[model samples]
Target: MDPEGARIQDDPDVKVMMAGSTLRKVKSRSWKKQRHFRLLEDGLTIWYKSRWAGRGHSTFSVTEVEAVREGHQSEVLLSIAEEFPADLCFTLVFHGRQGNLDLVADSPEEAQAWIRGVRKLIHKAQTMDEKERLDQWVWDWFQKADKNKDGKMNFKEVKKLLKMMNVDMNEEHALHLFTMADKSESDSLEIEQFVYFYKMLTQRDEVWKVFQDYSGDGEKLMLEELENFLRIEQHEGEQSGQHAKELIDRYEPSETAVKQGAMSLDGFQMYLCSQEGSIFNPEHQNLYQDMSQPLSHYFISSSHNTYLLEDQLRGQSSLEAYIQALKRGCRCVEVDCWDGSDGEPVVYHGHTLTSKILFKDVVSTVKEYAFKTSDFPVILSLENHCGVEQQTVMAQHLSQILGDTLLTTLLDGQVPQQLPSPQELKGKILLKAKKIGGLEQCLDETLTDEVSDDEEMADGDPESPCTEDPPAANKKHKKSKLSRELSDLVVYCKSVHFHGFEHARSHAKCYEMSSFSESKAKKLAKEAGTDFVQYNTRQMSRIYPSGLRTDSSNYNPQDMWNVGCQIVALNFQTAGLEMDLNDGLFRQNGCCGFVLKPEFMRDATSQFSPEKPEGHQGYKPLRLSIQVISGQQLPKVNQKEGSIVDPLVRVEIYGVPQDQAKEETSHINNNGFNPVWNETLNFVIHAPGLALVRFLVEDYDKASRNDFIGQFTLPFTCIQAGYRHIHLLSKDGTIIPPSSLFVNISISELTSGS
Candidate 1:
C-alpha cells in the first residue's frame, strides 16, 4: 500500500498545509515579513514566495527537514516572543549543519498545521523503502528538469537534466534513447517516459555479467543456482540454501518469480541494495556490544567547546550547539564557564570575541537532550573559570534543572574501587571537574581546595613541548578555586593533573581522570604507548585539541584511541575527515556513544602498543581483498553546467602504525552516473581488532588535489565478507542516498611468517 494514499485522508494537518497560508519568515526581531507558503501536490516539497508572480521564490524538500519545533524554541523566535504569541511560532530544523528555519503564522491553527504537517512528511520520508525512495528521487529530478513547469520535457531539457544528474552521455546515443522513450511520435516526453529513459540509461552491465556467471539461463537464477552463488561467492556455509530462498522471497518484485523461487535481474539488484547486502554487518547495527562493563572499558564520544558553533576566538555561543551534540549521541560535553556581568556564569571561550550564553540555559538544554538519543551517562566536563559566588550559582542551576539526573552522591553510598558501568548510571549526568576532596568527602560543607590550572592552559603556551627551556615571556599560570557546592557534584571522574605513568600506576584512584592536549597525548602514545594503554584500564583519560588551534580544527581521534583513551574530545562544530572518523566509529553499537574497546586494551596488565603491535596477546593478522566494481548516482564535485566527475575509489585502513595503508583505482573519465572499475585492492592488516576501513570516492584531478565526492567508514570486525553495497555520505555526514559503491570483500587468516 502507498503510505501517502493511506494517510492523506486521516491527516487534517497535511490537508491544511496543502491549502496554503501566509506566514512571516523571521530572520531577526526586525526582519519579519509576510510570505506565501504552500505544500506542493506531490507532498514531498514545500515552496514559499514573497510574490506569486515572480521567480523570486525558494523551495525545500520535506526530506531535508530533520524535525519540527513548536513554540519559541529557536533563538530568532525567542528574540520576537514579546511581539508574537508562543503558539503562533514554529521552527524547521534540518539535518547536518544547516541553519534552522524560524517562522510565525497569522493564527495558532496555521502554526500547528505547518508543524504537524512537516512532521508527518518527515516520518514518511524516513519510513520509505529503497524502491520508493528511488521513485521519489526520479520524480524530484523530473521536477527540477521541467524548468517551464509544463510537466513535459524536450530533448534539450532532457540533455540539461542529464548533466544536472552527473551524467556526461554521448549526444547521439542520448538522442536515440530519447526517441525510444518518446512513444507519442513527438519530440518531448512526460514524467513516466523520463523514468523509463533513466532505467535504460542506468542498467548495470557489471551486475549483469555477475548474474550471467551464476545463472544457467541469462534471465533468472533458479533456487539451486542462487544457493551455489551464496556458497561460493558469499561464503555462507551450511545455511546458504535457506538464505537464498529468503532473499528471493523478500526482494523478487514479480509475482511469478516469487512463486517459482527464482531471482530476476531486478530482484538480484534489490537484494544487493538491501541491508543484508551492505558492507557493514547487520548484527552490529543495534546494541549488540556488552554495556555492563566498567565505564573505562569503552571509548566515549566527546565534544570540546560544546557551546560554540564556530571558531573559539570569535563565534556564537548558543544552546543549539549543545542540543546538536547531544542529539548525535555525544556522551561527554565540555563547557568553559566564566563570570557573567549579571552574576550568573556565562559559557564561552574567554578573552575571545565569541558571544555568551547563560550557564543556566546551557544546563537546561543538556538536561532536555542528554538522554534523548542514548540513555547512557553524560559527562559534563566543566572548565570552571568562575569565582566562588558564581560557581555556587552554576551548581544551583545544574541541581535544579537536571534534578534527579544529576548524580550528587556515590551509587552505593561508598567509595568505589572502579567506576560504575553505563547500565548502573543510566539517565545520569556525571561531573568531570576538579574536586576539593576525595569522593567519600563530598558530604562535607566547608571543604575547599586550590588546584593549579596547568593542564587547563598547558596547550595555551605557543612553544613546542620538545623545547628544552621555553622563555618566561610565553608563560601563563593560574589557579582555580574549588567551591564545596560544586565539588559535591563531582562524585566520579575527578579531574587531576598527570604526574607521570609510574606515579599514576602507584597512586591514582579508579575514579580519577586526567586531561591531555593533543600534542602531549600524541607524544605519549608514540613514546609510552604501552603505559598509556595499561593506565586507561582502571581510570578514564580525555584527549582534547590544543588551545593553539584557535580556528577550532580537530586532530585525528584514532591515535588517542590507539592508546585506549576513553574521552577523545574534538570540536563538534568543525567538519572534516577527523569528525567523519568520529561519526563512523560511534555509528555502531546503537550509536550510544560508547564503543567497547578491544579485549587486549581492557586488560589491566595488557602489553599492547600501537607502535609495536606484535607484542600484544591475542594478536592475529588477516588479509583483506576488496573488488572495486562500480558506482551509482555519484554526485558531481563541480556545479558547472557541463561538468561531470572523473571518479576513483580509494580504500584506506586506519589502525596501528603498521596497519595504516591506502590503495586507489584508476579514474573513470567523465562518468559519475555509472562508472565501472573492475579492479581489486589487497591489504594485510596486523591489528584487525582495532582497524577501521574507510572507502573514499574522489573526483580525480591532474592540476590540483583530488576533490572528495563521498565516503563511508566502519570497523574491521563489523565488515561483511561478500558482494555488498557501500552507501555514501557527503562531507557533512548526510546520506546521499541512491549514491553508492557496489563492491565484493573477502577476508582470510594469515599463517606464521608470510
Candidate 2:
C-alpha cells in the first residue's frame, strides 16, 4: 500500500495531503520490503495497521496505494489496494467497517471484465418479454411510422410521422435528419440512414449495433425486407408455441374470478367488507364521509327516502309518530299548510283538512322533540297552500310557537308580520309571495270602506222607521268589496313590523304575470314599508326596479335592494337562477335565500347525491317555468300573385347580460309558438337581457328569399338592465328569423371618473 494513498484515504473528506519521508516511516516493513514490486508499478504509497491481528496472521496489511505519474513528479494515481494474493494483489472494493467487502474489481483484467458484464446485464434487462412494455411499445411504434399508406419514408414523411407522434421538431431540425446517417445527400436514404432513423424513433441505442450488423451493404432496406424483419422479430418467441403459451400464462388475469353486474345492497355490503381499500372509490369515500358526519342542519325535501324517518312518519299520522321519526334521525320536517276556517293555522294540502294532520300539532311536537334532544335541533318549514290571509295567521302562530327556529314559511302570496317576542325569528320567516299584486296588496291594504248612496228614501217610507238619515238603495259588489277590504287590511298590517317576502308561483303564473308592473308594485311596497319585493325569476326584469326612469322597463334586484329592500327572494325553477346558484351569484349579490317547492328541492338534491338513496319516490309540483320570447309567420316568397312562400323562419332570443345565454336559448326553443304562413305569431316570453333580435331565411335564393322581409326588436320598448323577456313579433314576415340565439349581456356600473 502507498503511504500517501493511505493518508489521503484516511481523511477522504479532507481537501489536501502533504507527502514526505516522515509519512513513509509510518508504513510497515513488509510494505517497504516490497519496494521493487511497487516500483514496477507507479504512484505507490503504503500504510500499516497494528491492532486486530489473527493467529499467525500479519498484523499489518496493505491499506492504500498511490501510483506515481510517468512524467509528472506531483501527479499520482491514488487508490485503495487490498491484497488478495489468491486472486489479485490489487483489488478495488467499496470501503466497509470489516475492511472493504463489496469487491468492485480483483485485477485490471477484472475491471475490463466488469464493463462487459454490465453491458450484458443491461441488454438482458431490456430483452423482449422481460423489459417494460414501454420499451417494446416504442420499437413497435417505429415499424408503423410510415403514414399516408406510403411504401417508403422520405425526410418529409419522417418529419410528418414524428409530428403525428407529438415529437417537437422544427422544419430546419427535421430537414437536417436527411444526412444524419446517409453520409451523402442523394435525395434517398441508405440502409444505415433508415436503421439510424429507426433507432432515433425508438429511442433505443442498444439495438443500433444489431441493426448495423444486419444491414447488408449498408444500403436502404427494401420495403418487403423491412416488413419481413419486423414480422420475424415480433414472432420470435411465438416460433415455439410452448414458450408462447408459457408467456401467455404468466400474464393472464388473476386466478380469482370477479363477478359482474348490478350489485344488491347485501352484495355491496359484503364487497365493502372484503375490500382492503375504501369501500367506495377514494373520491366517493371522502364525499360519503363528509355527508355522514353531523351537519349543523340537514335539509331534506318531503319526498326524500334515504332514511326510514319519512316512512315511519307515514306509518302513523300522529305528531308523536313524527317525533319518533325524528328521533330516528329526521332533522327537518315539512308540513304543507292551508288556511283553516277556525282562524287557526292548520296543516293540509288544500282547503280541506279532514284527513291530514294539523300544522299546530306538528309544530308543537317538533318543538318538544327538539327540546328533548339538545344536540339534535328540529326545524319546520310550512309549505302554505292557503289564501294570503290564512298564511298571515299561520305565520303569526308559527312565530309564537317555534320562534326563531322555524326554518322557512312557504306562502303563496303572503308576508308575515314581524314578531317582537322572538327577535331572532324576524329573518327566519320566509313569505313566498307569488306575485307583485299579492305582496303589494299585503303591504298596502288598510281595510277601508267606500260607500255611495244612489237614492234616498222619502221621510214617510218604511213607516218612518228610519232615523233622521234615510237608507239608500243597496247594490252589493262582492269582489270589489273584498278587494277594498283586503287593501285596508294591508295598510293595517304595514303599520306593524313585517320581516321580508318571497315569491313562490307555478311557472305558468309567473309567465302570465311576466308583464306585471314592477315599478307600480315597488312604489306600493315602499309606501307600505316592506323590506323587499320578491318574485319568481320569470319576473326578474319586470319586478326589478331601475336606476334611471328611462330604462325603468328593466327591473333589477340591485336597484330594488339598494332602495332599502334587504332581501330579494329568487325563484329557482328558471334556468337563469339555477346558473346563478352554481356561480355563487345568489350568495354574493343578495342577502335573500332561495324558495323552491318541496318537489323541486327533492329533485335537485336527488340528482346531485353521491349515492342514490333506497326506495326513492318522485314528487311533482307545477312550478317549472316555460316562456316564449318571439315568433313570426313566413310570407310566400316563391308565389307569383299571392303564392305563399313557405320559407322556414328562425327566431333568435337575447337575454340580459348577466343571464346564461344557453338557458335562454333552450327556453325560447321550448316555449316559442309554432307559426303559420299567414297568421300572426304570438308567444308569452321570459328571458334575461333580451336585447336586439332578428330573423332571417336559411337559403338566400331569389325565389325563396322574398318571404323574409322584416326584423323585429324585443319588448317594442327600451328595457331596464338585468333579465327581461317580452312578446316580440315580425309583422311583415319578410325577414327570415334566426333559429334562436340566446345572448348573455353584462353591463358594468359606470365608474365615477369613467
Candidate 3:
C-alpha cells in the first residue's frame, strides 16, 4: 500500500506539494517513468509514486539531498516542451547514494514548481527551532486522538495516538506504555504525561531489547556471555570485563550475585547512558595528550554564516542560530555586522535579503550559551560593515554582554611570540575582525557622534529597499576608521586578508590570523604542501568555503586538515557526508571541538603530506582479520508489522587513499535478532594512521535503496584489539547496548621486504 495515498486523507504532518502528475526517476537505472511526486509539508521527506503498474511508493529524506535544479534550465526545458522529449530531466544528487536522481518533468511548469518547492521547503525545515517543532508535533497528536473532547486520553485513545503516528505498536507494548504513563494508576493520561510517556517509552524499548538479547534463558545473562560482551561491545579487554562485573554487582545487589552471570534490566539503562555515552575510554589518555601546545595546534570546530538559519539569500538571521551552533560544540561563529536603522549595529548577510538581528542580541545569546558545552575560547568572526559610530556600539555590546568573559588583553600582556593555549583563555570570547590601526592611534580618533551618520541606514526588514549616498564626487571614499573601543577588543584574532603564503610569514606574531578562501587553501595545499604545513604550526590559519559556492556548501575538510589548518569552517545548517566525516573525526578526546594535530603535521621538522610521503618511518601495511559472530538483538526500522529489511553487517575501512578504502560484509538475511553468520573477513590496510573503521548495520532491499539501521566509527589506533562485543549506536550517536555484534579482530603489520 502507498503510504502517501494511505495517509493523504488524514492530512497529518506531511503535506503534499504536487501529487497528481509528476515524474520520478531513480538514480541506479536508465528507466524513466511517469510518476506522482509528493513534496512533504514539513520538508523532512518527499514521497513518490509511479503512475505505471510495476513501480511502488518510496520516500527520501531531505538531509540526504545534496543539490537541486540544473543550470537554470527551466526556460530551455519549457521552450522545448512541445517536442515531447524523453530525456527532459533535472538531477538531484544525494550523499553516499549510489546514483543521482534524474527527475523527469512532462512540462516546464512542473519542473520549475518542483525545483522551487523542494529547495524552499528544505530551507524552512533546516531553519526551524527543533524543540518547538517537537512540541508542536506532540500537541497535534494529542488533539487528533482525543475524540470525546476529554482533557486526558484513555487506553483506547492512547492506542489511537500510535496509529495516527503510523507506529506499529503491539497490544502488550501499548499496555506497557499506558501503565508507565499512568503514574497515579488512574488509567488516564494528560498532555504532560503523554509527552513524558513518549520519552520514556523509547528508552524502555531500547533497554528492554538489550536485556532480552543477552538473557539466554529469558533471564539474566551468564557470566561468560557478560565477559564476551564487555570484551567485544565495550572494546574493553580484561580490564573492562572486571569493571563491568563490578558495575553489575554494585547496581544489582541480587541474592544470586555469585551464582548468576549477569544483572537484570533495572541496571541496564544506567550502564548504557552512563558508561557507554562517552567518546573515549578512560585507559586511552594518549589521544588527549599534548594540550600544552598552543591552541593553534588543534583543529577547531567552526561554522560559516552562523547567523543565517536557512538560505544565504533570504533566511532569517536569529539569536537561535548562535544557540544551536554553540550547543553543538562549535567554537568559532561568524557574524556579519552592518549598520542598522537604530544607532546600534545589526548582524545579517549583507548584499542580500536575509533578515537582520540586533548585535546585542547575538552577543547575549553567545554569552549565555558559550562554554556551556565546552570551556574552550570562542572566536566571534565579525564581517564588519558598520560605520565608525555603529562599530563602537557593536563593540560596547560585546564587552557589556560578555563582561569579563570578553577577551580584551593578551594573555601574557607582552609582544607574544607564540599563540595562547586553549587552557590559558578558558571562558574567553575573542573578537576576530579586520584591524584598522594601532590601538593608540585608534583611541585618539574615536568619540565621533556621527561620521556622516551613514546617510540614513536601511530599514531592518529583509524586504526593505536599499538607499545610499552618492560616491564622494569620484574623489574616492575616505578610508573607514575603527575607534579604540572596537580595535582594542581585537588584540588577538585580528583577521588579515591573505595575499600569499610568503607574505603571511613576514608577520611572526601568532595573534595575527590569516583567512583563506576554500579555493585558495586547496590551491595552496596542492602547490605548497610542505611549506603550508610548516606555516600552520607557528601561526593561526583559518579556511572558509569560497563565496561563489553560495549555497553554503562545504569543501572537503580533509584537504585543509592535511595541511594543518586550525579552523576549517563548515555550514552548520547543511547536513551531508562532509558533516559525517567531521563528526567521526572529532568523536575522540571527549568531543571538546579541539583535535590535536597529527604528529607529522605538528612536527614542523618532518614535512608530511596527508597522502603518502617519502622518507617516512614506521610505514608498514596492516593485515586485519575480523570475525562476524552474531547480532544479539537488532531492532526493526520504523517498528512495522512486516519489515522488508534483510539485515547485513558492513565493515568499512576508510583510509586516505581513494582506492585502497574497502567495505566487506556478511550475507543479508532477516533473522537479525539471532543472526549467526560466523563470517570471517580480512583486509589489507594501506594507511593506518589516517584511517578509521566504521561498522554499519543496513537493511537490504531488493527493490530499492538499503535502509541504515545503526553504526559506529572510531580511529584505527584507538580500538582495543581482541574478541570484543561491538556495541551498536543509533544515527544520532546514542548507544543501544546489549544489541551488539560480537567480533574478534586481529591487527598485525606485515614485515617489510617480505
Candidate 4:
C-alpha cells in the first residue's frame, strides 16, 4: 500500500465524497443534466451514472485524473456560467488528450468536497513507489476479474484475466500455481490469494539470474556484495558504499534485511526501477545549465497556432490550449488576431472554420500561467490580421490584462546590443510582432509610416494568407496597416524582412528578427549552413511549420535547431515523433524552456554546418555502445484477448548528417514480458552535443508495419554511462512505469575499428 494513502481514508474531503451527491454535468449550454457521482469503497475510483440512462455506468480511476480545476476554468463550464454559480462549478482534467469533465454541485461545500477529495487521491497516486504501484496494478486487475462482486476469482475467471493481461501461459503450469495459492481449500481465490498467484505467474526469472550473479546466497545480497555491484555496474565510484546502504534502507521491505545491511530480490528490483536507475542523470534533472546567456544563444520552446486544440481548419479555439502550452514550459505562444464583430479582437485561423476566442481572454490566460512552470520570459507571436481600430483594442487588452508583466518599454532604458537574457527579463511577456520603426522612432513619435516587412506575413503560420501562395502571388497579397498603439509595444522582437545573409550581417539591428517557413529555413540551412549558423549568433530567428499541414502536424524541429534557430515553433496539439524530439531537447535546464546552443553554434566567427559537420575544425568522433539487454512488462499493442506481442527494440540516433543512424534487435516470439536480447549496437557520433538518442519498442509483424508500443528519447549529452533502465512513455509522453528497457551503455573516444 502507498504510504500517502494510509491517511487518505481519514481525510474530511474523502468522507464527504463517500456520502455522494447529484451534480449537473455541463457539456454545453443546452446539455446540463444531473448525474449521481460517488466514491467507491476502494477510495481510489469514482463511479458515476445518469439517473435516466438505465443500466449504463462508468468508472474512472483516481490515477487517471491529473487535476481538478475550480469554477469556470473549462470551456463547457464557462458556456453555462449564467445557469450555475462559479462557487458551485468545477472541472476534472485528465492526463493526455482526454477531454475534461465539467460538473456543477448544488452547494459550494459539495463542490469543494469533490474537488479536494479528487486532488488528494491524485496526489497519493502520483507519489506511489514502485512496489506500491505494482500492488495497485494487481488490485485493479483483481477488481476487473471479480465480475460477480464475490470478492474472489475462480479458475475460469483467472484464465480470462491472464488473456486480458497479454499472457499466454501454459494451462498446466498456471493450474499448478493457482492450486498452490488457493490455501483455503476453495477453488476460488480471494484478493490476497490472487495477488500471490500473480506473483508466481509473473516471476521475473531474468532479474533473479542477475541477482544470483551478484549475491553469495541465492536469496539476498550482503552489504559488500551490493556495494561491489554498484561500483562495477552503476559506476558509483567513491559513494558506492553509501548509496548501497541508502538503497537497502529505502527499498528493503523486510526489517530483518535492513538490520543485517542486506537487500532481498524484492528490494533489488525496487532500486532498479526507481528514479536513481533511470537512464537520465539525476544531476541534470534540476536547473543545472547556465541560464545567464543572451536570449539568442538559447533554443526557446515555442508553439504554433497555440489557440487551436485540433486541426488548423476546424479546430476549437480555447484558452485552455494556451494554459496547457505555458504549463509545458513553452516560452513562445502564437495568437492569430482577427477583427471580431463585438469590437474585440479574436484569435483563430483566418479564412478557416476554426472557432474564435477573445484576444483579451488569451492575454489573461497567459498572464496567469506564464511563469508557473519556469521563471523565463514568454514571447507572444502575434499574427495580426486586424485593421488599426481592432489593433488598438488588442494593444489595450494586452497592456491591461498583462499589466506589469508586459514588456512595453526597452530594458535598461536603452536598446540592447544583443537581446537580454531570460534571467534578466524573468516574468515578463515580450511581443513579437511588426514594429513601424526602430526603438528610437517608437519613443520619439506617436505614429510613423508602416514598414513593409515581407517576411512578416510569410511565416507560413496557419493564419497567414500568403502562407501557401507562390512567390509571384505573394506580391499581390496586401499587408495590413500597423497601428502605432500595437507597434509601440514591440520592444526587443521587431518583425523584419530577411533580405540576404550579407544584408543581415551589415544592416540588421539586434532588436530586429525574422520569421521563416520550414521550407525556406531548410533551404537556407542546406545552401548556406555556415552563414545561417553565424547569423543566428547575433539575431534570433523563428521557424514555423508549413501552412499546407492543415492537420496541424509538425516538421522535425532538429532541422531548425541544427542551424541555431532560437524559436522553432510546432503544433503542440499534435503528438508524434516530432514533438517527442522537441520534448527531449527541452527536458533539461529545469525544463525552463531555454537551452543554450553548443559553443561552436554560439560563436559568430566559428564555422559549423549541420550538412557537413565532419569538416568542422576540432571535430573528434566518439564511439557509443549500447547493449540492449532486456525488457520488463512491455505493453500489448493490441488489446484483444489471447493477443501477446512479439516485442523488439530499435535504437535511433538523430544528429548531423553523418551521425544519424538506426539499429534494431530481432523480435522475440509471443512475449511481452522479460524478453532478452543481449545485442550491442555501436555508432560514431561526430557532434555528440547536438545528438538525441531514442529507444523505441514495437510489436513486430512480418506482413505489415510494426505497431508502436512505447519509446523514450533524451539528449546524448544527458546519457549516463552505466547499466540503466529506459522508462518508456506512451505516444502522448505520459510515463508507463514498469514498461522499460534494460540497457548497458558505454562511451569512449573513437579509435581504429576493432
Mark the 10 consecutive residues where model 3 has the least summed lDDT.
455-464
Candidate 2 regions exceeding 4 Å error are: 1-300, 304-316, 320-358, 368-393, 407-754
For residues 1-754, write the lDDT of model 4, one tens digit per residue: 4345557887999988887789988888888889999987677889999998979998988877878999888878888888788999999987766678899999999999999899988888887888888888888778877888899888999998887776767899889999999999799899889989988876777677778989998989999999998998777899999999999999999999999999999888788778888899888878887788889999999999999889988889889888878878899999988889989999888778888899998998899889999999999998887779999999999988898999988778987888888888999999999888788665577554465646545333533443343456446455547788888799999888789899998988888888888998999999999999999999999998887888889999988998899999999899999989988998888999999898889888969999888777867789999999889888888887778999999999998878889999999988786788989999999898899999999999999999999999999999988778899999988787668998889888987774
TM-score of each: 0.95, 0.21, 0.62, 0.95
lDDT by residue for model 1 over 362-477, one digit each (tens)?
A: 89889989999999999999887778899999889999999999998888888898889999999999988877767766656565466555444322222222211234623446
- As a whole number from 0 to 100, the lDDT of residue 118 in candidate 2 is 28
CA shift of 95, model 2, Å: 71
Best by lDDT: 1
Residue 697, candidate 2: alpha-carbon lDDT: 31
The digit string of per-residue lDDT tens for model 3 on 646-738 reads 678888776554314556565556555545566878787665666667778887777888777777777676665544556677654544433
Query: RMSD, model 3, all Cα superposed?
Result: 15.7
lDDT of 2 by residue, 1-754 (tens): 2233234334321211112111111122133221101110111122222233343222211222111111111101112223322222222221111122122233445433323332332333234231232223333334456444333467766665554333434567456665675556665554446656544443322223323333443332222333333234322233334432332234322222112112222222122122111111222211121122111111211111111112222322334344433433333344555556686655532322224555666666666555332232333322334555665565565557766554432233344221111122222322222222333343454534322221111101111111112124223332111123222222101111111233323222221222112454465444432222223222221221221222112233322322222123221111121112211221111111211211211221222110111112431111112122222222233323223222333444332222212222221111111221222222222222122233333213454333342333422112222112212222311112222211112233333453
lDDT, each prediction: 0.88, 0.29, 0.65, 0.86
Model 1 spans > 4 angstroms off: 1-12, 52-54, 440-479, 752-754
Each prediction's total of clashing residue pairs, residues at least 3 apart in sequence or on different chains, is 0, 56, 8, 0
